[model samples]
Target: MCFVLYAGTSMPIPQKEWRNDVPGLSVEALTERESPIAVHFSKPEVRYIGSTSGCGCDFPHVMFQNGDWPWFDDGEHDPEQEASDRYNREALVNLLQATGEQTVELYGVWDGDFMTPPAVREEIALTVIVDPSFRFREQGLYVVRVA
Candidate 1:
């Protein structure tokens, strides 16, 4: 049950690192430069590559669309897209939960990131793809507390 976790709000700064107990999982602070483009040109086929050692954790390897692209836009998650979007999100969350990061927090997610990234809007959807029931409640979205 391999999956890619979309963490943080809006376009991630790309500098912020998401730390977790999962060993191989790569905590990337994504931004439009990497994600928006990935979705814009993602492939239609979705494949789960179980887990891998590359990231040091048992993170699932999702074969994103076209093999080269890392993300996909399954159309708008509106009324028409709700069922499928929920299915995808649930399946992804379920897999993450099963892997032990049950409390993985999906951050920076909103309704608009699904439609598209407007030049001025800039607010991208960041999802806490993991389920909330997991013990890792502390692992959800939040702004960094600065001193």
Candidate 2:
């Protein structure tokens, strides 16, 4: 699966508070050995769309780059990269909604490990949302239309 990096204005709500929000699924939290940040989770049967980069790749990497993520701009840019960023942001939005968490302010998807083969990377980037509500009918970009 593709990797999406994310950051929010506030820390995610504690598992104790949001666990029950996702019905019929079990949530497991993980803490990185090198960092104090705890933003990883695991859930069974959660039909995640897009590519899967195996275990330990399920969580978004929390980034703090002085707020200089490339996607956070409105100037002229590459159309393909813009769409990829949008798709990732929309995925994060839907994920947060599904888990009953507040929307994050910064996030974007990338080819996991930066070592995926070019062909595989291209396919991952092109994975469209099959859910009608999230798919932009004419543009082919995925977005959270209902929430």
Candidate 3:
């Protein structure tokens, strides 16, 4: 399963609540079958979608393509993960600032068997808080945090 994370307005609304308000937008609460990222957050605001769905396009592909997720083959000390961690933290901080929300809810879109061959499964974990102070923490295997 491929997981995509998004920083959304901190409104805890049920998935069905979007049926009439969002039109074509598909929203469902995280379930047992949810992706690892979704399960990590365990928030009612989180939603899951098919990998092939256009929802995956919500995030800018250029962000990831621009070395956001990088790898080094030299076997020497690799900083790619650190770079990615910083990117994630900055991205979320910008999101919170843009939304002017004290706390922004993190959303995970899991695209499981619904994606094609070119798309490989991915997992990401992020927790953010803006009240009192600003902080972003990655909760999955790839742990990265900023406060």
TM-scores of the candidates are 0.25, 0.30, 0.32
Compare the candidates by TM-score and give the number of the best one.
3
- TM-score: which is higher, 1 or 2? 2
Model 1, residue 38: C-alpha shift (Å): 19
Q: lDDT order of candidates, best first?
A: 3, 1, 2
Error of 3 at 27 (Å): 16
Alpha carbon deviation, residue 80, candidate 3 (Å): 2.1
List the candidate 3 regions with Cα displacement exceeding 4 Å.
10-77, 112-147
Compared with the true structure, what per-residue lDDT tens digits does model 1 show for residues 1-147?
A: 212334332222223233445422233433444355234222221111121232212322223233232434566446533443444445444444443321222322222343333122122122443332121111122221111
Q: Given candidate 2, what's the lDDT at residue 17?
A: 19
Give the range of the ten consecutive residues with the poorest summed lDDT in model 1.
133-142
Please give, for residues 1-147, the per-residue lDDT of candidate 3 as tens digits.
345443333454334322433323244455564434433342335444211223433322211234233433465543664443444445344433544434444443334421212222233233432231222221112221222
RMSD of 1: 14.6
Q: Rank by TM-score, descending?
A: 3, 2, 1
> Per model, how many backbone clashes are there?
14, 3, 1
